[model samples]
Target chain A: MKRNKKMIIAFITPALVTFLVMFVYPVIRTVIMSFFKVESLTASTSEWQFAGLDNYIGIWKTPIFRTSMINMGVIWLVGGVIVLSVSLLLAVILTSGVRFKSFFRAAIYLPNVISAVALAIMWIQYVFSKKYGMLTSFFRALGLDNLAKISWLDSDMKFWAMLIAFCFGAVGYYMLIFLSGIEQIPQDLFEAATIDGANKMGQFAHITLPLLKGVFKTNLTFWSINTMMFFVWSKMFSPVETEASTISPVVYMYNIVFGTKGVTQRDAGRGAAIGVTMALFVLIIFFIFNRVLKDDDLEY
Target chain B: MKKKVISAVLCTTMAVAMLAGCGSNGGAKSNSTSKATSAASSAAESTSAKSKSTEPAKAEGGKNLVYWSMWNETEPQAEVIKDAIEEYQTESGNTVTVEWKGRDISTIIQAALDAGETIDLFDEDYQRVGQQYASKCMDLEDMAKAADYETHSVEALPTALRGWAGSLKGIAYQPYTSGIFYNKAMFKEAGIEKEPATWTEFLDACKKLKDAGYAPLVQDDAYVLYSYGFQIARHLGQDGVVDLCKNGGWAESEGALAAAKEIQSLVESGYYSEYAPDAYPNNENEIGYENAAMIVNASWVPSEITNNTKCDIEWGMFNYPTVDGGKDPATVANVGAQAFAIPDNSKNGQAAFDLIMKITTGAFDQKMALDTQSIPADPTNEEWPEMIAGCKDAFNALTNVYDWNMGLNTDADLKTVIQDNLMKLFEGKMTAEEFIAAVDAASK
Candidate 1:
């Protein structure tokens, strides 16, 4: 017993130390920084002025920051619904003894394997381009001039265009998760359901969904975290500058912290406050998911 | 018992491996620090030796100078710099170690400086070097005066540098002016004999171009603020524009509404292309393809368009047309430059300044301008690149230069608001009044 405990301690120590240094310490520092007036990220702690809630209040009052928050919220709620539904549907279809299941799975999961930056560039340059774009060409070919004329990268449509592209890339990863969760359920339950005269839809509704509550909660939590940290797609869509239509909280934080071409004021404190706000958003979602989807009593 | 022994061996190996990884990093860091220390000491010794000797005493092995550059290794400018470095080494008996840090150098330079990195000299945008990293820079006033830098370099550039940095902190290497970069072929095709000098003439030119079945003007979304800001700056000087952006009284500003209305007329008259303010490099590319006649952009646009589209274009430039009753004259234009600065922590400031002078003046300046299709920093090197040759007159006529975006981007919070509404105004989605009202409301 003594030897086993000693071995465990020895094995865990490195990881524990790494986690404390890399993750926990940064988290604590960021939270503390949110309350201070830190102009530069490299500024010494001695130079920090205690601003209390001023940064938080200032960030909220900034119109661009508020726009970013709304944009994030929309991406989270709307993108979550589309991504979850599509991914779950694909997961179900793939697992229903479908033909070419492996090939289909690989095809769908390909995007997740690609770099988000490259994927976003592909979307922006090829798909959303007004001139010589795939969508424009396709719509024009179909004699849909009105649709063809729509500038997909315009301010009004850019956000939705980015969301659709991001969601398209995200579906594959979540589908794989759903696939694993679905595959874990015993075959006997489904056989029993079929034997009890439950149709395919009925079986899915009563057995599959109820059993997958835990997976749904997991996916929701992951989605919440991903959405909170959303940056790359927004950045790619607005490559030269941050647009009001595509700005997210993280991008806003980046602009204020690191400074962009147009916006040169670096406010590390406000950036920290934005970071804290995003963390709280993710935490609140986690809490809500835990309370709403109780998976403890659900048997495998 | 055997499994336990294997597990113990594996764990011990893993621990050793991790320790070795960390130890290697520490060793490398220490090695680099010692090297830097030696380099500094050598430079100091050389400086002392030079002071004592009538003839310059070259170190047995040349003293090292580290330079962090904003250009990529593959860029033509970097190629010119590399060639200049070789020439400098042979001429002055000094070794320059250059790290091509690329465009993100601006974002990371401060951190590197703060960390006490052994950076002797670095180059970035003149405005950025002046505004953001002024304290990190060595005051170059004495060196500049001794070298007669103001006489050698573009007159306005050093003056502009002083305006930003409050003293001579850096010297411009590659100066550029922002104006209307247009397709000269399109101008000839439209029978526009002369480049527009005022707002009415500009509108007449636009009409002729439109009548010739061409889009008169095109702007990329990236440069919408710059284009609009120039118009506003023509009305109210760059300072007034900055004040308006910082403290939002756009509707009440003397010529803010007038500028908006002028831009609105352009929009209404179909001066802008169908996709006027398309995403960056898109609308600019249109000019190369002959889909558009002109774009209000920096002198770099022609090179960018050519590089991206591989299209041959007869490019010409003129200053942004003067607005009627504007505060600033046509002479007041937007000028910017890339500059070299010696770090405050540099042990070899004189050597770095010498290297900067070598790269920026005489033959090297002309070489850089020719190779990179950029303006020559040295006024003595009068051979302008073919594409931007027309910019020389406008550049020379400049009495004052404005900051990037005419200082409208001074306020971080309001930049997005101004940019968004400006885009809307250009797209004809919002009227001039609505645009002013929207910006003013956002300010409050």
Candidate 2:
């Protein structure tokens, strides 16, 4: 037993060291940094002023930060619903013994392969442009002149327009995950359900969904993670400093740390505080998901 | 067999552990180096800048210098600089590699310097000397004094360009003066011979242009600030601007109201293009295409027009029209572009300084002025861009030249506030008083 214990310890040592160095150290440093007043990222620790949670309090007081949180919540909750629902629907259709599934999957996945900057430009210039845009022309062709005249890229509608574009690019990724989960269920269970006078809807409800609990949890976690780190789309859409409508916590943190939004000052401590808060939020969401969406490991 | 497998795993784990430890050590070393490098650079900058020691000129040898330029290859300014580099290489026999960083120069330079990378020279926004990379930049005051730079520069060196700790830092790579760029042909067609000298006459010209079926004044959302900046300059002056930035004093100020009211009137008069809300250079393009009569833009606007539109535009520049009964009626709002800054860690500081001096004072400056159709720093150089040639009287007699921000050394956020409120004012969403009140609230 002693020799076995020694072998187990030895086997785990490398990964343990990697984790402590890469993950544990940085996280601890960031948490510590959150308490200080950091004027510059490149400044020495001696230059750092100990503010005792002042940085956290300061971010809380900032109206823009609050606005960012509300924006992020909308993206996470509203975008989450649309993405999951549409992806599930697409997955069900694709896996229902549909023909030409391969072609359809590849076509849907095309947007994911493009860079965020290019995709944003295409949406803004080609789709949402005030003149000669796809949406405008389509609306006009359908004789919906009022709808066609609406400026999609205007300040009032920009947030929803960008969100729709982001969802268009994101739906395909989650759909693939759902399709894989559906395919993993035992064929015999569905056959038996059909044999017992169960219709397609009943089979899906009894067998398919229950089995996809693990996949749903995974998809939810990923969606939350993506929502938390929502910077690129916001950045591409705004191009300059983010607007109130599109600002996210990650984008806000980036602006604070880099002073890239023409704010004229860097506050590394405030940025670290934002990071810690975001991490905490994500952790809370993950735990809630795990608790609410319980699943057992089942074999085919 | 189990013993052998366990032993093999143990060996592999130990090796991996050792490798991880080594990697961590390497990372720590790099971080320490970055810190040390930045601190050393700051120290060097202070010493060189304060003492103003005449560092001896070195022999033009095989040493190569690296230059990171903000201007892309396509810009006329970039073309002029490239030609100068080649000329310098042949004449002085010194080697230099130029990296065209364009709009990404800010982030790229910041990251590179943070990583302890060597950057001998770079062109960055003049405000950066005061705001962003102050410590990393070498103070060129002593060099400027030794070179008698002020006399040769286009405008008298303003103290606002000082570094954060109050030292003359970078020299202007190029300077841009903003005003009305109007189509001379369009003006003739409208039966207006002379450019407007006052706000009232300016409006009259706009009316005439409108009567002639031309969009009188075109603007875009991107640079709407320029439209009101000239009027703001006349009201605030340099000192008033500084005071407004430091204290909450903008609400209902005569200058602020006049400027705001002026823009609101122009916007309400239907002088602006229909596509003014479109992205920049689109509405500005109307003047080049002869769809619009005039635009309030920098000296570089014509270059943009040429590049983006196909029309053979007969462009002429005028000083931003004076406001009748304003504090400084003849104020010219001049904006300086990125300047050449040497890194404190540069291995060849003298060489970098020499190259910059050569570019700014020598024939290269003249070439740049001719090619870009903009003013050069050296006013006595006699080589004037054709468009600016028409406005020589205004350029010479200009008593005040302020940045579009009115030279208010405030937070960039305050500038954004001004811009946003100004946009709101133009859009008819807010009154001039409300706009000023908003700025006042933001300042507080």
**Steric overlap count per candidate:** 0, 2
Taking the tens digit of each residue's C-alpha lDDT, what string does model 1 give over A238-262?
8876789899999999888888774
| Best of the candidates, DockQ | 1
Model 1 stretches astray by more than 4 angstroms: A1-14, B1-62, B90-93
Single out the weakest 10-residue window by summed lDDT for candidate 1 chain A: A1-10
- What are the clashing pairs of model 1? none
Q: Report how far residue A182 has shifted in candidate 1, in Å.
A: 1.3
Task: List, residue by residue over B1-444, the lDDT tens digit for candidate 2.
Answer: 888687877679787667866752211010112232333333333323322222223333445677888887777788887777665554343567777778677656765665556667888777665567767778887678876677767553435467343776677756776678888999999999888978888899999999999999886655665566666776766567667777767774787777888877787888777655544545677777788988877777877787777778777778887786776666456655667888888887766776787777657778878887777766657868775676555666666566544543344446555655665676666787888888888787
Q: What CA RMSD would you report for each candidate?
A: 3.9, 6.7
- TM-score for candidate 2, residues paired by index: 0.82
- TM-score, one value per model: 0.92, 0.82
lDDT score for candidate 2 against the true structure: 0.74
